[model samples]
Target: MASENQIVVLDGATARTGTGCMHGISWFVAKLGSTLAGLAADLDASLPSTLMTSIQAVADQHRATCDLLHPGTPSAVVALLRLNETVLEYLVLGDVTVIIDTADGLQVVADDRVDRTARAEREEADRYPFGSAEKQAALLRMKHAELAARNTPGGYWVAAADPTAARYAITGKIPLDTIRRVAVLTDGAARLVALFKLMDWPDVLELLDQHGPTELIRRVRAFEAADPSCMRWARNKRSDDATAVYAV
Candidate 1:
């Protein structure tokens, strides 16, 4: 749900969609955090400013569509927060989740990726590789994208039918004094919370403290490497597009 066409922080928030969208507009904004790793194409820096531009673009498009049709609007969109910047802010659409780090430790700030449709798709795809090698051979036994598409949803939200569109934001932030270090990972990595019996932010933060974010990312990658080609699409708890952003 991140809208990052270009990089840099903006100084203002403007509504680009809807009538009177200004008064109640939820413009993306947040206090910038430390150690940023954003994904413009591969990645970038700054959270608040970058997202403002992104959300504005989406809103503008939505307004334009609405203009074309009587009150037409595109799906709500969420912008990615720049990791470290002068301010902190982000936008979201769908269900991509954003976690923030505070003195109490880590906590969820926003969610904007996946949905019921996406979940069902993940479950069916889980039976295959990308999760387990058996999955590939099993899928190979099938036939084409049509069959696999049937296994999941239309492949729009769940299946990686398209990689370019598959990339998305899982966590974003500008964790200030409340947190010392933080980690932003896609829902796939967070899935370890239940499957592996790990705790939420605090618990994760504890583990992160002991092992360090570098090690944390390394472990996650190890799991990814072990999986078959279907790893990115594994239906298991932690098998969608995998990404992790850690910082203090």
Candidate 2:
């Protein structure tokens, strides 16, 4: 949901194994969004400084609702942004991304450390057919490596049940007047540019300016529909859940 001049995008992680209640991720995201909104009202504290407290509040809510600890339950990546008259503040956790429309051009901010760790396995999986046993084995290997790297030093971080992950978030502030607009996107919606290379960031900005966020998602889904087996894309899911928020 878009708040005031803020854009928040949250995507629930695909369950690794059994189908349990992934409600925790949504709950965490909602609480986190609210916390950040509340914190944004006070410009006295920097975004990075307030991050830990915001994360802890969400973690506490998660524990109270799901009764699960870090690395135990499902998690989600988050992309949050606030644009005021003076400054544009942004925070990115996990693989979600923020695209800012700057006076010079479009600037993209994304956390891809998770992708760096799984490249080899992803390539190996792509070597075999989609449903082949070899492909499955390779994918499994990739998933294991990714899991091991999560929330650790030298590894990627996400907004899991872990409060400490707040420290891993990428955050900063830019001159508000320099930014024309901003888009907060989950990995699912960002596949068009990141995974598929269907368009560059500038092209994405053009799309957003013309048709809006829904058009961008529709374009990605259309591409996926044409390549249902992911034959051309070589992805984990044929179609992933996607979400985006645009603030102008």
Candidate 3:
């Protein structure tokens, strides 16, 4: 007789104006035809939609004719996987991250977006005050981005664009046959994940195990309420978009 089968799930999220990354990974996932469309619409259409649409408009005017434009305003997201024994593969454009709880601690996997060019951009920012530098950088980045759009014309990522231009791209292929669980998250969730001395799915699962999803978000709200500074990470560090998910 067959044993109790395992479950696999693939979850993900996106923002309009990242480094044009969600589509690349989403394209791969959609091609794989796994559990769900990696970069689908947000559940909280009322709030996420408004922010995405508003931010995306500003990002649109930023592309250069040579670069790939973001399809819409960047939004955070989370994706999950529930499967028996198999392999897990994933990719990211912006900061959306993947954590694998292996025999070791939480293994954070990310893509190559912050390269030499990105480093140079950062160095330039250091030359000025954080606020003014951010504004100037935003403007310059958008200026070059606009040039890319002109060259590419209708070219853009995932049929959208975002203004902030924050992004990351990361993917992983793992042997799920031995793995116990996996979690996918955007920058927002990452903030909460860091709160723990040990950031692992078991912790998250434990929270979900005791309370429900509502409670998890509620905890986050309460946590945010207490520190409030923590939310700043969601705004400044992981600012663009956020999402998180887990599957065992």
Candidate 4:
């Protein structure tokens, strides 16, 4: 979601078997994203505060019917950019990548605490064949480990029922004049550079410059199609939800 002064990108977490919420991930993200956008438009509050309020608002809506304390409750990674006359402010929560093309160079911000946690389990899962029962078991272990660490002080945080998680988001402001362009990508769309190593960040911005965001996502899909069995990529999912937004 984008407005003249603000851009909000949310990648909803895939729903687990029991998310504890009556609504789906799509509904969670939509509600959170729209609420964030509306609050951001006011511009009086900081991005983190706005996000916190938005999260609480969403939680309130579902608190009556849902088990908000469930570990697998719906959540999302967020990337938000707000532009004004003097500065461009950004907030990144979870794995969403926000790349800024500035006069100095490209600046990339991503929260990788999730990757750092459950390392042994994830590595074990990666060692087995994609479709084998061994892989499934390893993957389950990884998920359990991740759940144990989720939203704790030493663990990773995401936008879920807890509004305080917004305070952990990476945030900064840059002089608006120094920025040339900006690209926000969900981890899926960023697989080309992050997971596949097909290109560098500069290459990614260059590709966005020449071919546009669609082309970047197309390349990711092409790579996923080539490695359908995950033999080369060794990913949990053969394909993920890919989303990219470019602003200049």
Off by over 4 Å in 3: 1-85, 103-105, 111-169, 194-202, 227-242
Stretches of candidate 4 off by over 4 Å are none
TM-score per model over all chains: 0.42, 0.86, 0.43, 0.97
**Clash number for model 2?**
0
**Which of the two, 2 or 3, has more lDDT?**
2
Instruction: List the pairs of residues colliding in candidate 2.
Output: none
- lDDT, candidate 1, 1-248, per-residue tens: 22333222211112223423222222312211101123343335333334334444444433533332212112222324443434344433233344556666446754422333335444555566453666544433332332333213343221111222223433334434444544555554554552334456666666666776566556565665565464453433343444445455
Top candidate (TM-score): 4
The global Cα lDDT (0 to 1) of model 4 is 0.90
Candidate 4, residues 24-134, lDDT tens digits: the string is 798999999999999998777999999999999999999999999998899998988998669999999999999999999889998999999999998898888777888
Model 2 error, position 193 (Å): 1.5
- Please report how far candidate 2 places residue 94 from its true position, in Å: 1.6
TM-score, cand. 3: 0.43
Off-target runs (Cα >4 Å) in candidate 2 are 18-23, 62-72, 128-137
Q: Residues 1-248, candidate 3, lDDT per residue (tens digit)?
A: 01133212222233223444433445433332221232222322222233234334433433432133343322222222223137554434334456677655566664323222334443444344324546456536543443343213242222134422212223345676556655565445555565432345567656654664455555555555654432333222213223445555
Q: Which stretches of candidate 1 lie over 4 Å from their true place?
A: 1-79, 82-87, 92-97, 104-106, 110-113, 118-121, 127-179, 222-241
After TM-score superposition, what is the CA distance of residue 135 in candidate 2 from its true location, in Å?
Answer: 4.3
Please provide, for model 2 over 46-154, each residue's C-alpha lDDT reduced to its tens digit, 9 standing for 90 to 100.
Answer: 6555666777776665455464553436667777677656988888888888888889877889988888887788788777766677877887887777777888898
